[model samples]
Target: MAHFVPRASFSLPGSIPKTYFLGHHHSGANAIKGILNTINLVIECRDVRLPLSTQNPKLESLVAGRQRLIVYTKSDLCTDSPAATHTLRGLYGADNVLFWDKHRPGTTGALLRKLKNSARAIDALTGLRIIVVGMPNVGKSTLLNALRSAASPEKKAKAAKTGDQAGVTRKVGTSVRIVDSEEKGGVSGGIYLLDTPGIFQPYVEDGETMIKVALAHGIKKGLIADEILVDYLLYRMNHWNPGLYSRYCEPTNDVNEFLTAVAKRDGKLKAGGAANWQEAAARVLSLWRIGKFGRYVLDDLSDEAIRAHQHLLVNPHLSQNQAKKLQREERRRARTGD
Candidate 1:
C-alpha cells in the first residue's frame, strides 16, 4: 500500500471575491470614527482561528492613538495552537492581548477585571467609555453581552443582537452600562460599552485570507461555495494531521471523496442515495466551527508569516482607489478571459 501524501499547495480560484465591503461596513467605519473622541478604551475582538485575517486594517487606523485591548474571541476553538496565543501576546503586549471564550467564566472575569482597572485609572465622572469593534461575525456583540452579564449579574438579557452570520448588528448600539458607580464598588463613574457593527476591510488582496475569513463566517454566507471552502479545509487538515478526518476516510486530496464519506456517515443523501455534496460541505463547516474535527489556527504563524503580516499592515500594497482599479481589471479578465 502507498503512503498518503497531501498536496504541497492549494490553488486559489480566481472567482473568489477580493472584497466583502457592504454598505453597513462603510457606515459602521464612519460611525466608529465619529464616536472615537468619546471612547476611552477600544475593545477589538478577533477570531482565535484566523487572528491575522480577522484584524481589519481600517479599524486599526480609525482607533489609532487610543487605548486598545485586543481580545481574541472564541479562543476555545484554537486550543490546538497554544503557541498562537503566546506569539500574539509577544507581538502586541502581554497586557494588551487576551484570549476569551464565552463558555469560560474565568476568562470573562479576567477581562472584566482589566476593564475595571482601566476605569479606576481614568476615574472619570462620565464613566470609562468603551466601544467594541471587529470584523463581521468575530463576536463583537457576543463579547459585549458577556462582559455586561459578568459585570452586572442582574441584567440577564443580551444588550446587542448576535447571530452566526455576518452583519447581524447593522447599526451602532446605544451605550449599555456594564458596571456601576464607585458607591457600588465599581468604577469612579462606572464603565459603559458601546457595541458597533462589524467592519470589513475595504479590500483583501489575498484570496487565501478571504477564504480563511469565510471559513470563520466573517463574510456573508454563499459568498464562496461551501464545497470550495471544505476543499481548502480538507487541504489544511491534511497538512495539520490527516487523522483529523480519519473517521470519514483516509487522507485524500479529492474533496468529493471526503464529502461523500461525510454524506454517508451523516446521512446527507439525496432521494436516490446520491451524496449531497453541498449539504455535506456545510455539515463539515458547522462541525469545524464548533471544534468537532479539530481546534487550530488557520493563519500561518511562522516568523516569516508574522513579519510579512506586520509589514503589510504598516504598508498596504494598494490604496482604496488602486484596489478598486485592480478589482475592476480582475473582473474584466474574468469576463473576457484575458
Candidate 2:
C-alpha cells in the first residue's frame, strides 16, 4: 500500500492550459468572455462527489469578479450527509452554493428562486442570461435539459446532448429560453441559458484530486491507466471502510491479489487459464462509476483539509506571487515530514 497523503498536502495549479481556452469560434472560454459583459448571473455547476476539486480553479478565476452562484449538481449520484452539506456551505459560503438533483420533482423551482434572489442585485433589463459552466461530464447539458422541460411542457425538446462520457458538447450551442414570465406556475422570470464546452486548467499538481476527478467521470476516460485508477479506488475504499470489497474477493489489503481473485472467480481469463486481472480492474472501476458499490463523495475534506481550503479561499488580499509561494511551501512541508 502507498503511504497515506493528506488531501491538504497537494499543490494546485496556478492556471489552466491554453488549449482549454482555444477551439471553435463560438466555444471554450472565449464564449464566456464574449458574453461576460452581458451575462447577469453565472451558474457554476460542480460534481457533488468532488465539489472542491471539480470546481475548476481556472474557470473560477475568470468568473471571480462576476455575480455567481455555485450549483452542486449530481446529488442523485452522491451519498452526501446533512453534516457534509453544512460543511460545504461553510466552505463555499452558504448563501452562494446550492444542491440540485435533476431527477427530483420541484428541484428546478427551488433553483430558480435561489437564482432570482442571488441575482436580485443585477439589472437584467434584457432578461437574465445565466451561463452554465463546469468541468466535463458533471451534467451541464443534462441540467439545461431539465430546466427547459420544467419551464414548459411544450418545450420538451432537448437543447443539449448528454452521455455518460465527457466532452459530449464540443461547441457552444445557441441559447434556449429556460424560463418565461408566461410560464404561470413556476418561478417567474425571463431566464435564458447558454451551454459551453468543458474546459480545464493546464496542470494539476496533486495526485489525489486528479484521481477523484477521474473516478467521478469529470476527466475523460483513457487519459489515465485503468489499473492505476483501480488501485487508487481500492486504497480509498479500504481507507474509508475496511473490507469494502469483500463481496467480490477475499478480505485483504492487496489490490493485485484481490483483482486476481476476482478475475478467476468471474472466469475472466486470458489464454491458458491465466486470470485477466486488467479486465477485472476495469470492471471494478466501472462499478464504482455507476455507484454499484455505494454513493461516495471522493474528496476527503476532513477538518485539516477544510481549514487549509478555507484559508486559500478567504485570503484574496495575498499577492499572486505570495499565494503561489505559500502553496509551494505547504506542499513541501506536507511531503517532507511525512
Candidate 3:
C-alpha cells in the first residue's frame, strides 16, 4: 500500500570513461578552425535530451568570435520538459537559442529565415557561408540536409550523409547551397552551409556526463555497455515518473527485474526462455531514443546546475584539475579504508 519513491541519486560506476575523444574528433576541430575565417556563421547543434552534455567546450572556444546559433536538434524528444526551451532561451538569449525538430517543417523554416537574415546583413559577393558543428551524432548532417531541403524544394536528393550512430561523417563536407541569390527572392549572394564532423570534448571530468552522452548515441555504441546505460535510463525514468515504464512492470530500483519484464513483454529472450538482458537493454534504448517511453530532458536545467555549468565553461582547467584531485582522494580513501 506504500507509494513508490525514486532514488535521490544514482551511483556512477568507476569504470565509466571520461573521454570519447578520438583522432577524428581532433582533426575535425582543426578543420573547423582552418575554415573559421571563411565562415560567416556557425550553426552549433545539440541534442535536446542532453543539451549540456552534447556541447563541446573546445569547439565553442574555436568558433567563439564568430556569429553562433545554438540549435537544439530533436526538440520533439524533449516535449516532456516543456519549460526546457524557455530556460535555454533565458540562458543564451532568445535569438541565440533555437529548438529544432526535423519532423516539423515550421522549425526548419524558422532556421532558414534566420540564416537568410544573417546572409542579408553581410551581403557577401560569393555567398553567406555557414558551418554546422557539434558533438558526435548530434544530428549535424541531418540538420544540413533539412536546411537544404527546406530552402530548395526541388532538390530531392540529400546533400549530406546522415546516420544515427556517431562518426557517420568523418571529414568536413564540401559547401552545399541552401538558398538562392537575390534575383531568386533569396538572400543577396545566396546561402551555403558546410557540414563538419561532430567533435567531442577532449576530456569529460564527469562520468555521469559520459553516460548521458552515450545514452544519446553521441558516442560510439558499446563504448559503455547497454546494460549500464539502461540502468541509468531506468534511474532517470524513475525520477521523472515510474509511470513512464508502467506498461512493462511496477516501478522498482532493480534493473534486472525491469529488464526481465521488458524482455518478456518485447520477446527479447534466449532460446531457452531466459531473458536476453543485452537485447532487452538495446530495445529499451532504441525505444527511448524515439520517445516511446517518455520525452524528457536528461540534463538538470535548474538555476544551480546552470550556474555550475557556466562556471566550468569559464574556468575549464581549474574544474578539470579539481575533479582529478577529488578522484585521486577518492581512490586513496578506498585504499586506506579510512
Per TM-score, the best of the predicted structures is 1
- What C-alpha lDDT do the candidate models reach, one value each? 0.91, 0.69, 0.88
Model 1 Cα lDDT, one tens digit per residue, 162-240: 9999999999999999999999888899999999999988788599999999999998788789999999999999989
Clashing pairs in 2: 16-201, 16-202, 17-201, 17-202
Write down the RMSD of candidate 3 (Cα, Å): 5.0
Residue pairs with backbone overlap in model 1: none
* 249: Cα error in model 1, Å: 0.7
Better of 1 and 2 by TM-score: 1
lDDT of 3 by residue, 207-229 (tens): 89999999988888887899999
Candidate scoring better on lDDT of 1 and 2: 1
The alpha-carbon deviation from the true structure for residue 326 of candidate 2, after best TM-score superposition, in angstroms, is 21
**Per-residue lDDT tens digits of candidate 2, residues 256-304?**
8878887887777899988798898788888887776566787666899
Q: How close to the true structure is residue 199 of candidate 3, measured as C-alpha lDDT? A: 92
Pairs of colliding residues, candidate 3: none
Error of 2 at 2 (Å): 20
CA lDDT, candidate 3, residue 144: 93
Identify the runs in model 1 with alpha carbons over 4 angstroms from their true place.
325-338
Candidate 2, backbone clash total: 4
